[model samples]
Target chain A: MEPTNERHLLEALASGDRRAAERLVDETYRQVFASLVRLTGGDTEAAADLTQETYRKAWKSLPSFRRRSQLTTWLYRIAYNTFLNSIRRPVLLQPIDEQQAVAIEDPDPDQAAKLQQRDVAERLRRAVIGLPEPLRFTISARFWGELAVEEIARQEQVTGAAIRKRLKLATSRLREALGEDAI
Target chain B: MTQPTDREVKSLLTEVEIPEPPADLAARIKSEIPADLSSGRFEGTDLEVFDAPRRSPSRGWLIAASLVVAVGGGLIALRQMDQFQTPAGALESGVVASEAAASDAVAPESVQYRSPVDQSLDDAELETVLVEEIQLNEPLETRSSMEAKPDDSRLQEKSTPGPDVTSADKVVVDEVTAGQAELDEVSADRDRSDRTRVDQKTVASQDLPSPATRKVERSEPAPSRGPQPKLETPSEQPQPEAPGEQQTRARQRADSTGAFEKRQAAQPPQAPATVESTAVAAPAPVRESARLEDGAADRSFAGARAGSALAGSALADSALAGSVLAGSYQQVRSALSEGRWPAPEAIRRAEIVLGFGFGGPEAESKQESASPADRFTILVDELVEILERRQATESELEHLLRRSRALATELDGQPAVEELVVWIEQIGALVESAEER
Candidate 1:
């Protein structure tokens, strides 16, 4: 969303405009849910619950929202924090057989290549989920949620260089987890 | 299988499927949010409703009344103490009492007690005590000087008081008059010397034939006698005035401008050199006593000046330190926004110390001899700390940059290492630009 439009929406929301709240939910709920989906290791139900909690907390903290960062970055931070608070144990990825069964059902001539791609992608996702906290968030926000490094940094309240270092570290770890020829 | 490259890893990560949110999710969240949606309140949680009891207005009034009583009692006790202290304190108390009595006479109902007789008796005792103290402290030489300079009407006016004046009031008046007399004498000495110089110049001009000779004589610098010129007598050479004595004389002059002018009018004019010579020869002990007073005053003045200079330097140093901190913050902010690194020098020593875990006496040597990788780690840690603390320093940044560059070369073709090297170089450029500025 454009900054000016977001600013207007924020102003409207601050004035108790219910329509503005709905509009905000419409614009950001998908990206937030997607990020949460990855963070919860493909648990759609948990992601949905966390997304609701994230928006609820956002509303409560809306008045004190300093516009130092973009609204989306702020929401991403809230979502990330919400996920961290809710889940204490390591995330468990969905079993590979389920994904394999889904891939097997696809009626395409390139089934073998697609299946191999699906396996590699699943391994990559597990490697990403296994990565350390901030690294996981940095990589997930950058690729899964499609946030810019600068935006991720803003959300993390860190410099862009730090976020980039985290990405580099996360990727290096992922490379090690999955072998050299996996790509 | 071979390890994947960074670009390949990134591509694979992006290609992973992200599950879409259920269609009802947005509608459900919107339904949960209340229509009003005002700040500090939710539909069921009203922050304004509290169980704590409200304070009563009488408690506030009681607090205010107690404060007023406490202050009033303190002032009354202070006034009572003043009545039994020094004669000046007693006199001040007496004046206040008289004023209060006069006010009470207008409002008879407010008069609490009457003690006019005791007050008058106390005033009389303080006056006698003050007179005795003044007489006991007065030097025989000063008294003799006053007797010897009978023609000095200013001294006569000061020593003798009117019949209506109390002894304590007369002493206070005498002290003020004496200070005025001293100021007048100093001014008279100054005027005489000025006249002497003018008379000498007139004599020299009359003796010289050419206008050029007169101009040349006038252009010659006068002999420096410090701030105040002293009169030289043939009987006894004039003593140099001490800095303290000069300051005191200056203070006296400032205090009695009216008295100085009155004295100047009352006294008959005489030859500048002869009159000043007689005045200087008359008092020998006075100059000695003034010199003694001046010695203490000079020491105090010097001490005060030294203290003032120290305070000024401290203020300047604090200002400089604040500017340095501000400069570091600005550099970090500008670098972050502009996609570059900040100056290394602008980084603080504390952050470097904390970042490297260099706590002991050998921390410096450890930091100096740290491996390139360790140094790079320290550098990144320091940068993060700087961002956290909103502050940065130079030597650590330089060391970090050097190590990072060396490591980047050693780990060639690594994108992360290359990026870090470029960032450090940008910081180096920023430091260089700052230095130029």
Candidate 2:
């Protein structure tokens, strides 16, 4: 189903369409969870749990939506919102000084093992989660899910230009985070 | 074809291949939807029902049979006795017994109730005060004598959950949940090992022998399809399609890269401190005003008072919270009505000094110390202060609004002030209308 004209999907999802709801999950879960995992810097387990929870919330909240945006945008919004909700509990990120990063280097004899410890993608994830908010969220919205400027604007209740500007600043900050040469 | 230009590749990232969800996820998601939609009944209330302890099917049949037999017996008895006695007397007595049973059922409703303390004022007095205060948020709250009414420390927790918890609470909670406990002697031996995940995989992936002892492999996936596949090399990351898409795609990659960049090489710690600090605002225009959905705000405000700040009795009755909000909102409105703008510096001083005395985001960081509303007040105060300092004519202020614009640009994300900027500009139009008159 192209979900684009799947008004029935939405209606069914709204009126308790199990398959439509399943389709919604099948379509969006990977993107949503991957985006969240990226935003959260590879906390795979948390991302998985949050992904499931997002679907639950999205299903319950499907009726409340007044067709403000495409269902996909709404689903992404739900994912971000669920992630925010899950981390609301006290046990979240630790302070920089106190949190000792598990040493990246392993004295293991295998070359692959040593290389994986120094994996670039994983290192990049660490940098992303370290950024301050607003910037961090903006970056995630832009890169991970690749949401459009207007979609992000509507999700955040701001203008497209505003999101564009934030996206720009966020990029500059990302360059700074990733290192000048890395960009 | 030669590798596409950075701009070409940047565009493709937008259409980056988002992998399919793990198979079980769709099933899990499908199981969570509810068909019923009437939220008025569910929002703040859960269904309460009496589950009569289950009776066996045999017991049910036995009860039905007994009832039938008793009814037949009663009819027979009535037929025998009614031939001689007055049937009207029996009917009246039966009616009386039913009335007694009915009264027993209704007794709880009439058990007699004491009027609450606030009830003494009645509909007239309370509504009148609420009507007047509806315009002003509250005055008593600002009074020094009131001593900054102790906020229900837990209000943030109670109010929509997000705005309730403190930084310290967040940190402490994280520590409790994520901290490693003492391991057994056999497991402790693994601490000497370079990586731990292999052990978890070994335990979970029982097919692998000595998985815990196996070292992690760290090589990039083969760059077969899509854009650049490696991490540090931004050129390698997939780009979105189209020329105009360059700006957003590059911006997104830059952001993604920035998050992974770390100073010390180790992962950022798991704590509330980091989470709050990194709670990214949405990518949108921000203004220098604290805008909120009134309903959400009102709910949260009342929420702020409950265990967040109120006694159970006061919270049990929403009327009390509404009265408090009414009373305070009126005071703020009245003060504004009286043309009292608290010193512009007061907000900054309150934030800087109080924020330092209390732990804030940090002295230098750009993140807000208070919630968006409090931060917007600061920005609005700045706008007002900038206008005060310029002493420019409306046209001049419009020109001098260069200052407001500059500040707005610097703040970058205050949606309220950004919206107000349009209104402020519209005021320029209003000024021209006045000049025409």
Candidate 3:
């Protein structure tokens, strides 16, 4: 779906239109904070941070809206960067070059069975957090951002085949973690 | 437990919901945004919404920079041309000829040329000049008379007694006596000529002279024996200022500026008679003392050769110090990353100091050779090491990594290199897949 007129929204806010700015703040706050919480995994301080930061960023950036992607897409990208930053891990945005694809076979043969027993919520969060960055990114774009696989493929600049492959692998891992409890 | 069916897994992951943040989050975000906006810190706003474009210079900036460099360089080259400025009158004709000769080196200057004498200035070179056909009025003089002379000198015994040898020896003796006498006459002339040269320099400065003016200059007319002149001194050698003191009075003087005008003036400048002075006053014969002077000159040249050795030693010291500091900083950074180390600034400071490295092999050599530099480095290294140890409070990072590695090894059984890589990749994909959902 085409993104809404983010530039129009920003221009209204810049001119001291409290109503317009308030409406933007109200609309974006829930999704932004939820996304942060989802990314940080129940870290309350971080969730609140991610929420405030998104709105702040949106407000500040509203005036220069060249209207490329929808304003919401930008906010999502910022939230993702913030989450990636907070985790303080490595390899957040690695691309799947051909050489990399061949290497992505399962690392451990035996751990899948045992990982199925952990608390579903915690396990899901940790597993996703521990997952390789590319797969993790694909799943997050689809879930918290509510983007379709096609939308994600377009956003991630990857082939539709690659997106599906990542999704299949991620789902299997989640299943191994959640098992019978999930359904 | 196995990999869940796609439909079931996707459904569960989709069901996973993030709770709403506190109400204050919206207010906080709202306030910070406007301040960032009106502050004019950001160039363009919502454009960054999609992506933060990498900061890079525009083509115009690069073009402007190139123009600046070109103009600046041209100006410098023009200014440097001023020192060898060609005079406006007859001097310009000679300068043009010289320039033509210079260009002639490349061929195609059409001037009828005689055999080209290589005019490149080496250590020993003299310029071309023409002299007028005037007779020099001079006479011979001598010092020792027949009364004080020894009847049979040791040098006389070594002389060949053939008829031709006697005639040749008499001619040589006569020339020697005449030359020595002329040098004596010019002893006072040396001082007077120097004053004239100085006066000429003052005159030359006022009006630019023609190129045709004779430049009958000698690179070395006077033997130098003073410390002041150095390369410009023309001729300098150490002469003992005092009998026992190490001080050698080395005096050097250049041809005073007005040398051209004075030589070209109505009174032609007199060339001093060449005198090979063999009468070195001495108390006792010391072969080593003469060698000592030669050795001093050798030492001056040796200083040039020794330059690289000294620089190499310094580089090695710096590298050694650098590695030591780098090792320490890396340890500290790893510590900081894991939260086992505190005080990032202090660690950063320590790293900066440590970066130069403590006393390694290079430092040790430097310690011996350049003690002051090495000592300063050593003190800083010691300080960094002390600070690093203190700031790196907890020591569990290594242990944690070991545990992580061990668990990783046990879980995966440390497959073959390629297999292990594949497994890591697959696990990575799984992990990433989970995160995405």
Docking class of 1: acceptable
Q: For residues B1-437, what per-residue lDDT tens digits would candidate 3 score against the true structure?
A: 55567785566566655665786777675555453443323333533543456746777788889999999999977754532231111122333344334333421111111111111111111111000000010111111221012222522432324434444445444543554453343323433443444344335423322222211111122211111121211122232111111110100000001111111222223311111132111100111221222232233234444444422332233233323323444554333233233343545443333222211112234236633223333333433443445422122323322333333233221111112122122223333334457
Regarding DockQ, does 2 or 3 come out ahead? Answer: 3
The 10 consecutive residues of candidate 2 chain B with the worst lDDT sum are: B282-291
lDDT of model 1, residue A182: 53
**Rank order (by DockQ, best first):** 1, 3, 2
DockQ of 3: 0.20
Sort order, lDDT high to low: 1, 3, 2
Predicted structure with the largest lDDT when compared to the true one? 1
Query: Which prediction has more favorable lDDT, 2 or 3?
Result: 3
lDDT string for model 3 (A62-112, tens) is 666555545565677677877777566334323359978778886876877
Off by over 4 Å in 1: A89-116, A180-183, B40-437
Model 2, A48-139: lDDT tens digits are 76777666666556668887777777777778766665556535433335235454344665788445533444444555455677766666
Q: Write the residue-wise lDDT of candidate 2 on B207-292 in tens digits.
A: 32221122121111211111222112112223211111222222111121111111112223431123122111211101000111
In candidate 3, how many Å is residue B191 off? 35
DockQ per candidate, 2 decimals: 0.33, 0.12, 0.20
